[model samples]
Target: MLPKRSISKSKPSKVWSYFVKSENGGKCKLCQKFVKSSGNTTNLTNHLKRNHKKIYLNEKQLEIGKETAGPSNVNLFNLEAKASTSKAKFPKTDSESKYSDINTDERMDSGSEYSHRSPTPTAAKNSDVNVVICTSTDSQSQSFVSQKGRKRQQRIDQSFSDISSFSEGGNKANKVTNAIIFMIAKDNCPLNITEKVGFQYLMRTVAPSYHIPGRKTISNLMDEKYEVLFKLMKDKISSIKHFCFTSDVWTDTLNSRSFVGVTVHMVCENKLLNLTIALEELSKHHTGEYLADKLSNIFRHWEIPLEKFVAAVTDNGSNIVKAISILLGKSKHLPCFAHTLNLVAQKVCEDDAIHEIIKAVKQIITFFKHSVAASDELRKRNDLKLIQSVPTRWNSTYYMLEKFVKISEDVGTVLLKFPDAPRMLTAGELQIINEIISNLKPIEQVSKEISGDSYVTASIVIPLQNCMIKQISNLSPATDIGKHLKQIILSEITKRFGEIEGVSLLTIATLLDLRFKTIHFNSPLKLSHSVMKLKRLIEESQNEIINEETIEEPTKNENTGSIWDYHMQLSSHDKRTRRENGKENNAGINELDHYFSQPLVDRKVNPIQFWFEHKLAYPVLFEIAAQYFPIVATSVPTERLFSRAGNIMDPSRNRLSSTKFGRLLFLNSLELIGIYNIQIK
Candidate 1:
């Protein structure tokens, strides 16, 4: 029998000899360019055929020579006929029309189209082997294409599964979670927002790797965040040497829940820092003792020392005032200046003559608000809308009267269209309204200027009020009712704010302020008293510093061999005695004299900035200024907290627990003041 021809099993393609194989594919040895084929040699072969034609032709000749030697030497699985046939069958089409179908009979074999690349002349001598190899390779190619599609689909599904299983502690997940929490707190969103279908869908779309936490998880996270921020805020407050607090009680109409809010203010590093320190549920009756105990607890919880409490500003409510006095001291409680001004406005509006005029204006505004046609006509005549005074908001009455005066003619025309509208104001009534607005205008402006918490409002209290009084007194009204209104406002102001300059806190603050140092004082006795009190504070501070120094024992002389040791001891004793005596006798008075002797700083200059710049020049005075400058002129900051709480206690979140509500409001306040930032780590 003839010796059997050795047939090699399928092996790596010869094209690999010119390339280096990698996990994904291989790189060409000659040009070092990558070609991806996923362990297949079709693309590798194409790379050589396109750019290395000479080498490709040489390899082809060697393969063809071996195949033609005999049928037994042929390895059918190792042939490139299938790749060539696939290329011919799926020629590259225009990119835009690459997916367009070409009509063909499904029954036809791939070999029929394979006629596009005719075989070489040498292949005809081995037609039987060539024909057999091509037929088998064609079937294998079809299976390979189908298998590739399945592998691609499997990869896509695996990626999606990986994304869905992101660990909760992953950095991306934590970042997204923090952002959601910030949004919920800042916007006062309902806790159930994360559980809503639309919110979940949005999260998934934006960050597929992040798992949307449930409402319970979000709530727990918020609690943890609040605790962390609470500790941070406490640490910050601990560094402050002095603080002024504003407190108020608000009742939520939606849930009939009562809450007390307290805000703390201080000047640190020449910047005004204010934060909401407490927003707790008021479960007990709001008596002076109950509220006082609650405030004491809050102060204790924050670790605030009694000596650090400069004062507490609140509305003129007897209960709250008594509460503050009970906790801090009788002299440590200050009534809100803006609230007092509001009272003045309210009291004057109660006059029979002004009440009738306001009543008529209210009716006209009501008609325009209810009738769309009348409102539209008014808008056409003038863009200004008639305002209705809200009893809760200060200056709202003045705003209403002022608006009516501006659009009085338009009001007449619109009222003509509605026969049932209130009668148009007479010329005399119009004159009275103008006069009232003019008189109240200066008071309104003063109220706003002093209600600020971001600047040295305490110092401006006396100056601004003095200026307002002067401005109002200069105005001469033509109408008798206007004159009566003016007199009522002046008397009310005097009755309410007449004793403000007598308060030690405001008096000293004004003295320390460069812009109005004893300049706005109407009472020489009060001014002198304020000067004496300030000098006493300075003396006390100096004594404290000296005591602290004396408490530190001097280092003992370890080696007393030198004869000058005795002289050194005597010199140190004399210097120490002279320093103590000098500070006690002249430090406070000299600093005070020096500060007052300097020309007044420009009114436009910030008082805080001025103090900071000259702290070293007037260290004793700066210390006192630090304590009093942060005392806001009004309790508006606390009032603002309640206003925000009202929005937070909307219908959807009326069932929210008081603890969570307080946390949300606290975090929101810190965010506004830039004290708290979300940490994603």
Candidate 2:
């Protein structure tokens, strides 16, 4: 009914004599069973041994005879003559002789090429003998062969039916797919990366068995991963007693889309943990009411109660401040200290005297930025390149001025070669630049020190502000511009952070820190007020603990005897001794006084570690520290999230949907803190 499949003649095997070859497998001539070729004869030999034992034994014996018969007995000319004569005598039919001519041609080609294992005497003798036996078979055997051919066809049909179950759902496939998903999330690779030619070629070369998933499939996997990680994050957050949130709104420049990024900070097991919890798209107006609702939704989604909310640190945006105030009374919101410092520095730059010198420096840097020749000439003279300052960046002006002063001489020399270049800064201007740098350097340093989320920055607010004020006030400027700059910076510092020490939240945190207990406080009234507030809180916490303990029923011993009376008396005596010792140690000492009596620890020590080590001694204070220490000094953590979001929404991936964009960012944030060690099963 159909055309017969042709078999390849290259490197003919002796096994082919007992089989009819097909595209994917071969059919045995002896018993009519199909065997998958898969490019070798191992299955064919097994079929012969299992279905036709006598033929299999004969084939094995023939192989042994060839090994025993030495090459000295094999005559090449005689073998060729015998093969030609045997082929003529057998006179094979078209179907049976199809392989006979091929075998003869192979032997001839082998002899001419001097192939190793030239026709052995036993192998030639066996081939000729088999040809005679096969030709002399009876007519009934021919009929049996045709019947077996039909059975072989039926077996081939059955084998084809089994191919449907072959799929890319194996364990190795799944493991590779999970690895690819993690790689995409960790590296922020575009979803379509799998569709690229080079990526496909790489997978084919390294792991040909694995099937790369499409973009939609990978997106779904990411969603599942996000859900798993979100639960892990939620479970972790629920166990924490206090949380401080930092939030900000960022607008993507390419698509003009806005996203609100919220990050949570807390102290857990003596370690400070921060997680980027939300990066949702802001489709509505960013009004105070709208933002308040969004913030509440985030907390509600995580199942964090309002009572556990310690404070929110954000920039001095009126809308966000009002939102936090509306959500958690006015006392729960704290202005970002770094943002306030940035305002202080920005305000100082706005002064006319300072503005003029900054303008001149900007113009000079601009000239070098535009001209290649002038820039190259300056590079030849100095290794430092001029830095350009952006208005929105903190400390950028000071950094630019600092660099310009270092390379001013080389810049002047370079400008002399170009007549059209902007004039170099005069000596008087240079003096002002140095004065500005000197005045602003302390502010820059203070900003960097306080913008940390890994340490107890809330406690450092009062002390650092005091240090900055003292540092700036003590500077003696030589010029009126320097003096004016000094006056402006001091005023800005005092105006912005002057009353920071009065805030009860920060005041208590500052006092609780062992490194600065009551040492940095200048106002006795505020200190007394903070002490009174702390005392009340500790009293309330102790009362609650006492109530909980009282509610639990004490266990009664059933085996009461006079023998345990001495143990009871010894316990009572120990209790009386402890009471007397407590009275001596706490005569007029409350928890605050006892805490202050201990020597200050080194400033480099982690306050969280200290509190954990001394929690039993100062349980109430430790509870308060847990609440207040997590309040970060700045909203920079949210700013960093927006920076990452910008990278994820690069030009090539600008069209990524908001949902996918958020998930990728969430996974990436987890990756940053080393919490994303998930395996897709």
Q: Which candidate number would show the highest lDDT if scored against the true structure?
A: 1
Question: Which candidate achieves the best TM-score against the true structure?
Answer: 1
Segments of candidate 1 deviating more than 4 angstroms: 1-167, 556-571, 579-584, 678-681
Clashing pairs in 2: none
lDDT of 2 at 288: 89
Candidate 1: tens digits of C-alpha lDDT, residues 7-80: 99887776776656678987554333468886579998887777545446545755565456422221211222
590: Cα error in model 1, Å = 0.6
Residue-wise C-alpha lDDT for candidate 2, range 377-452, written one tens digit per residue: 9988898999999989859899999999998989999999999998988898899889999999999999899988
Q: Which ten-residue region of model 2 has the weakest summed lDDT?
A: 135-144
RMSD of 1: 24.4
